[model samples]
Structures are given as structure tokens and as C-alpha cells.
Target chain A: MSDKIDNISVGKKANVFFDGKCVSHSVFFPDGSRKTVGVIMPGAALTFNVGAPELMEITAGECQVRIAGEPDFKTYAAGSSFKVAENGSFEIHAKDEVNYICSFGSD
Target chain B: MSDKIDNISVGKKANVFFDGKCVSHSVFFPDGSRKTVGVIMPGAALTFNVGAPELMEITAGECQVRIAGEPDFKTYAAGSSFKVAENGSFEIHAKDEVNYICSFGSD
Candidate 1:
């Protein structure tokens, strides 16, 4: 995977959630696509509600993730990814400080 | 000030600091310059060491900042900015969740 996303527009401000347990910035692609680059604090277990289908690509660290309706929590590590359907939610527990890029709108 | 930075590249990974109290994403400019978009958690009082002189521009929220060699703390709010010399440090206490862009290099 590319280390950086080029020629895109990014919001100057950040999107803070979970009282700062999760922090992310919004990146806008020229093709009208949007993504978020984020970091989750270690040992923080949080549930994220998805508005669209999302592909969560781990760039660093590891996490245990359980998508809504899934029976088991799966471990996702660096270079790994998981998908959540639109209108769904997922619970994530960061095994370490997890860095991830979240792509929305599709599986 | 511009709400979004266009035509730049952003790192997929986040830079987490202070036990995840501070998180930022690197933005690379075509001019070979770099900046970071970041958020500081509310009630967090932290010090950041500077490698190069930096301009810290507030994007949202508010904070009180005391740059090294300065005797007093000054409050900075949205659209405001401060400069810190290289090899120096600054203490910042967020009044709320603070969103800022730190542009490195001389003022």
C-alpha cells in the first residue's frame, strides 16, 4: 500500500471521537471519494457506527475487531484490513496504538 | 484562512504522542515542505519540542500556549496562530479539543 495519498484535499480540522480516544482527519479525493486517516488509543474498546460500507486498513499496530452481526472478534494487524457493511457498526479494541485508513462507501 | 488544504499528500499513518493525547497526520507539499494537522485532547497540558521553527495555526477550539523563553501563557483561538523558534519547546493546555496545523521551518 502507498504510504501517502497524493493530490488530495484535506480538512484542516480533525474529527474527534470517544473523548479523544479516536482522532481522525478527513481526506477528499478529486474523484469525490473520501477517506479518513486515524489513530486509536491502545486498550480502548470502542464501537463505531458506520454510515456507509467501510474498509478499515491497518497501517500500524494491531486490534481485535468484531463487526456488527459477526460471531467472533478477529485480529487485524498491520497491512491487514476488515470491512463493515453500510448502516452497520463494529467494536474495536486496540491491542496497541492502532493507525488506520478508513475508506467509505463500499466493501 | 482556508478550511481545506488542496493538492497535497497526506501520510496514511498517524503520529501519536503523549499516550495518544496528541495525534497528527503529516501533510506533504509539492514545495518540499511539510505540515501536520493535529488535535489535542481537552484538559491536556503537554509540551512539544521543536526540531524546526514552527507556526501553529489554530483550526478549531481554543488553547493556552506558552512558548519557551516566554514568561506568560497566551490564549489562542480559532484562526489564530503562534510561532516557536527551532530547538525550543512550548507548553500547551487545551481549553477544549484543539485542532491545529503546525507548519515547520523558520517564520
Candidate 2:
């Protein structure tokens, strides 16, 4: 993974969720696809609803994640990734913090 | 300003400060200059040290700001902005979360 994403349009406003436990900004690409660059604060576990298939790429920090229908929470650290299906949901916990790039419709 | 900033490269990693009270992503322009899109959470007053001169453009929410050398705090709302000189500092308080685009070196 690269350190930066080049040539994109990003919204000025941010998406703050769970009382700021999760925050993300929308990024738009030339091909019309979109993604979000976000940071999840290490706090109480947070559940995320996936509208489309998503590929969560962790760039820094660590997280324990459990996808819907999955029986266990897996650990993902920097340079690691995981996926969730469309219309699914997941629970994530970060003991410190998690910086991620979330790609939608990644199926 | 427009709802989005186009044709810019942004770092995947974020700049999280004040225990996540202030979070920003760095955006690079083709001209080699850089800016940040950030959110100031509603909580305590936060002081930001300026490296380059910065123009803080408020996109949403509200804030009371006091630039260094200034006597009183000024209120800035959506569609408004404030400037800080290089090497100076400023203190801001947001009763509600403030969403902003900060353009640097705008002198």
C-alpha cells in the first residue's frame, strides 16, 4: 500500500460516528468509485454496518474485528486487511487506535 | 467554497491530536503547497501552534477563536474564516463540533 492517495477529490466535511469513536472523510476517484479514510479511536467496541462489500485496510495501529456470521474476532495490524460482505456488519475494537482506508464494493 | 477539494493527493495516515479532539488529513496541491481538512470536536478549548500561516475556513458548526496577540475571542460560524500568522498560535473552543478546511500560507 502507498503512503498517499493521489489525484482525488475529498469532501470538506467529515463523518463523525459513535460520539467520535469513529471518524471518516469521503474520497472520490476519477473512475467514480469512492472510499473513506478513517480513524477509529480505541474505546468501547464499535459495530459497523456495511452497505456494500468492503475491504478494510489497516495502515496503522491494531484492531480486533469480527465480521457478521463469523464466530470469532480476528486481530489485524498495520499492513493487514479484512473483508465484509454487502449488507453485512462487523464489530471492531482497537486497544490503541486504528487508521484505515475503507474501499467499498470491493467484491 | 465547494463541497470538495479536487485534484489533490492526500496522505492515508491521519494527524490526530489532543487525544483525538482534533483530527486532520493532509492534502497536497499540484503547486506543492499543502492544507488540511479537519474536525474540532466539542469539548475543551484547544490551542494550535501555527507553522505556516493558516486560513481556517469553517464549513459547519461553530467556534470561538482567539489568535495570538489578539485581545478577545471571536466567533466564527459556517461560511466564515479566520487567519493566523506563521509561527503564532491560536486557541479555539467549539460548543458543537466544527468542520473546517484549513488553507495554509494564504498571505
Candidate 3:
């Protein structure tokens, strides 16, 4: 296991592994696991697929999370927590920019 | 497993099971596992022992986390993440009433 903590700045990106799948631009823990926390600027969007169940908490601002093929997006505000199953495809859009943390099981 | 999501208010308390010890006032996910997110007020203190390694992210404010018998305390600021091993004793003090999220593995 890689125990490296990486701090990525705005406009920069990193890759995180979730059960062998790659989630790009994911802020990782020091252990190089799938768990991460970072800020997402307004008008920004990210898409990825998770291989294990995932949990996220909206710490600041607000964002819209849409699961693939799902109608109607979910609005996540500060202090909100939600879960996504493994192998679920997700896309996140920041309405006015927001910061959130995401964690998932290790491979 | 209990897949219930509970919303807790300030000055309120809840119990979370880590391994077998009771960690009080822990905000849990909707799925009802150890993973949680909540706010810790200033001057407020909490003590608990985790059974699995924990990952926490400070979404707002600042606080001090001190492990049992540790000489000095570690300060966590907004946008910072840290880990605590399972079975490790820890105490958290909000320097000026901060809000943060704490998550851990299930039993």
C-alpha cells in the first residue's frame, strides 16, 4: 500500500484507485487509499466510476450529483451525507463551486 | 446492519460502535456503518476509541486532536485530513468551535 499524501491545487488533478478502477482528480488520504477530500470550483464537473461502495459529505457550498441514467439530480448542501454503491457511475456539477470529501472501501 | 440515517443537533449525542467500544456523538451515514460526518463545537470535547483506522477531514474551523498519553496535540485546519488507527484513544477539542467530518470502517 502506498502511504503518500498529495496536496493538489486548483486546476490540477490526481488519480485514485477504487477496487482497481481509476477515479481521476481524486484527493487521497496519506495511505493512498480511495478516500479523499478536496474542493470543486463553480462550473466544474467530474465523472468517474466506483468499484466499491462510496460515501461523501458536503462540507462547504453546494453541488449537484447525478447518477448515470438517473432522472433528476440530487442537490447536496453543506452537512449532507450520501452513499453510492460500487460499480455505480456518477457525475458531479458545482452550481456555484463547493468543497466536499469522499471515502470508499479499499481494493 | 442498520441502514438508518439520523440527524443530530448540537448539544445532542449519539453512540457509534467501533469494533465493540462505544464512541459517543458520532454522525453516521444513511447505511448505518461507522462512517460519519458532523460538527464539533468549540470548547467542546469528545473521547472515543476506534476499532479500525479512521480518516477525518476538517471542512471548517480549527481544532486540536490529541492521542492518549501523547505529549503534544495536533492542530487540524480547514481543508486538512488525518487518520487515526483503530483501537487508538483520542480526544478532540474545538479551539473556537469548528465543524468537521469523521469516518471509519464497519465492524
Give candidate 3's error at residue B36 in angstroms. 25
True contacts kept of 3: 0.00
Candidate 2 has which clashing residue pairs, if any? none
Reference-based lDDT, residue B73, model 2: 96
Q: Residue B89: error of model 1 in Å?
A: 1.2
After superposition, the stretches of candidate 3 with alpha carbons farther than 4 Å from their true spots are A1-34, B1-107
Q: What is the C-alpha lDDT of each candidate?
A: 0.93, 0.91, 0.54
Please list the residue runs of candidate 1 whose C-alpha ends up more than 4 Å from where it truly belongs after superposition. none
Q: After superposition, which runs of candidate 2 have C-alpha atoms over 4 Å from their true positions?
A: none
Name the best candidate (by lDDT).
1
- Return the top candidate by DockQ: 1
lDDT for model 2 comes to 0.91
Chain B TM-score per candidate, please.
0.96, 0.93, 0.61
Please tell me what DockQ candidate 1 reaches.
Answer: 0.87
- State the fraction of real interface contacts model 2 keeps: 0.78
- Clash pairs, candidate 3, are A42-A97, B42-B97, B50-B87
Question: Comparing only chain A of model 2 with the true chain A, what is the TM-score?
Answer: 0.95
DockQ of each: 0.87, 0.84, 0.02
- Model 2: per-residue lDDT, tens digit, A18-52? 88888888999999999999999876599999898
